[model samples]
Target: MERGNRESLSSSPAAAASASSQAQPQPQPQPQGLFLYHERQRLQLCLLHALNNLFQDKDAFTRADLDTIARQLQLHHPPQQKDHKWWILPLPSLVFKPHHNALTGNYDVNVLIAALEGSTHQKKVIWHDRRTPAASIDLAACHLMGIMLNTSVPRLRGFWTSRHWTALRNIRGVWYNLDSDLPAPQPFRHETHLVSFLDNTVAQGGEIFLIFNQD
Candidate 1:
């Protein structure tokens, strides 16, 4: 009986080890692509919400308005040559002014659209970009251009500078940087690299437009 009890104790540990191994949880595979897609969708929704909040009393935008803008942008393909001097779209009304407060950055898309649409060649009224931070103006410009061109504006990482509101176009998978003061569209690399370059420039107190590229 003692021998039998010893055998039982020895086998119990093996049984417990087996049970422990069986109860261990396996690592689940992460759905990275799905997560990214959902995140992009959420960002679009957030942009829409911000726009609604900004223009709720004014000419508010619906999802259809955004879709319409995106469709128009997709159809309007600008010239992609680096030597072309006339590549800059004439946004005469979208001028920039220095702001004393650095935090005055407008992130509302609806306000941007309204400003663009309501702009007249005669009046040339001062818009949000005039008072807002350069980074915010450039970001809004990129988003507006991206929607117009039916492209996905990739996420950017960089600080704001006092550069004027700038817009870049991605034509046939190539990037063309646009500045009103420049004579032509400047060719730049992808979004990540551009943001890194901007970050370095900002650290040195050099002003540059925050660049965004299509995915």
Candidate 2:
């Protein structure tokens, strides 16, 4: 009886150990591409939230507003890449210049619109003569001018090309060749929508900007 009791106790421990090991949750392995994709999605959400906060209670924004937004963005998501710089170029006015110490090279089109709309200084009228190929502008400049200027502006009728994609915002109130291959009269409900659209585009290897054109 004593030997039997000892054996049972020893077997009980082994059985309990086996059960405990089986009960413990195992970590599932994630593919490298999928993991990176999820991380990017999380980061994109953070950026969109920050932008939404920046636009609250404001109809139009200025360069100063962009500065504030940039600071918020940096605070929320610090630069992951070493010595990363963000460039801003306001077409036919200010050239590409580094504005922030972040890793992202893509521009934020919404911020560019806010900067241009809020500016008090009048931009000198420069018409883009169809006779001459409209000068190729950067992603930031193209979206900025497109959103801020009236469709009637002759200079605004040029085709703008970005690194990843080419799009035409409006040609005399007729939209054509828009980003995401979206159809004409794109459904732009609000600023948040615009930011979201840009975010999705950027994620899909599309070009963007975030700099405030001070000129």
Candidate 3:
């Protein structure tokens, strides 16, 4: 997530918006009825969980789907344009693939982009500029699809760090936080609350992504 795939922003998370003319607001996402699909934390696969939550479908994405994307990305850009080898035992492709953690699922932004853009529904993902508030854009005009958030977290005795994945979705005019870390989906009292919550999240080492149906 550092910089291997141009998937992460090197600047502090506080500066989430590097380009923006004004402010904005995303769509309203909430469960339709008594059901909500969410995947809990397991094997460091928050990105996988977040994607499913954003789509509001348990089978929206799978670990294998993400794995294949990571490998393809690696194959397109190898350090030496050949398989990495040491002695006679071929090195694992994971060693060269930084798009994800391989065994678990620390998928980077590149993987996220590829996965969603590859979706059959023709959905798209774009990074939000936190410098501009959500209310700046006219997402309420029925354009936004969802929001995937990446927050920085400490790891390995607070020495190293990793990003956590979560998402806010708009389903039928309501907003819900489908964070896999949470026991259940959390609905926002109103769109204002949703905007405030997102601003605060990105204020401290986080990135916001706006998902849409098309360009």
Candidate 4:
């Protein structure tokens, strides 16, 4: 993972990310069946995978592209500097910012918002606040593009935990769970089913970010 120019925070992070992600997106094929479910390896890159799945294109982004964004964000809004023991060398994890983990890729929601909003596709991220009722979100809305969900999963036989990114998007008139954990994209029966599914997910400590295109 190469770090971009670690010079100054005065420069815009979004501008840097735009240089790559804002390239005119090549036309992508629509996912039709099982064949489309076969996506590339997305190891520890659920944020990248969720973006590609939300946009329905494997080539939508790269780990490097997101990495640059992460770096820039860290540069602009760095965490509090701490004095380390003179004898101890600083670890990369210590320098890693909250927006993303430089080692293990557990990119947070801020990265998601930045990546999508910075891209040329003009997508907007609207976080459905936990205080609000899930049903209050009109599933029938015509402008809805998709939904990105962040779930916490236990790992190493429940010894540790990590965050996972997933998406709910409409394909061929059906809603599908484009979760990286799933072997195949699972389709929701209808809009109603999708709403209930989201409600349940919220109850279980999941966060939802609704996506839409700027008019």
How far off is residue 200 in model 2, in Å? 20
Models, CA RMSD each = 23.6, 24.6, 11.8, 11.6
How much lDDT does each candidate structure score? 0.31, 0.29, 0.69, 0.69
Q: Of the pair 1 and 3, which is ahead by lDDT?
A: 3
What TM-score fits each model? 0.24, 0.21, 0.73, 0.77
**Regions of candidate 1 where Cα sits further than 4 Å from its true position:** 1-113, 116-144, 147-163, 190-192, 200-215
Candidate 1 overall Cα lDDT vs. reference?
0.31
Off by over 4 Å in 4: 1-41, 86-88
- Compared with the true structure, model 4 gives a TM-score of 0.77
User: Candidate 3 overall Cα lDDT vs. reference?
Assistant: 0.69
Task: Name every residue pair that clashes in candidate 4.
Answer: none
Ranking 2 against 3 by TM-score, winner: 3
Model 3 per-residue lDDT tens digits across residues 1-215: 11001101111112222112212222224343244555556657888888877876767777898899888987786555565446755456535366887666788999888888885657777888878876675558566888889998766559988788888887667778877655456778688898778878878868988888885
Among these predictions, the greatest TM-score belongs to 4
Poorest 10 consecutive residues by lDDT, candidate 1: 1-10
lDDT of 4 by residue, 92-208 (tens): 656555787776577888788888888567788899998787788866567789899998876656998888898888765777777765544667777788888888888889999
Number of backbone clashes in candidate 2:
5
Residue-level lDDT tens digits of model 2 in 1-215: 00000011011112212211233222233442210000011111222222222222112332345556555555566545444235633341222223332333223543334333444522222323323322232333542433221111111135543222222233333222222111112334444455455545445544433323235
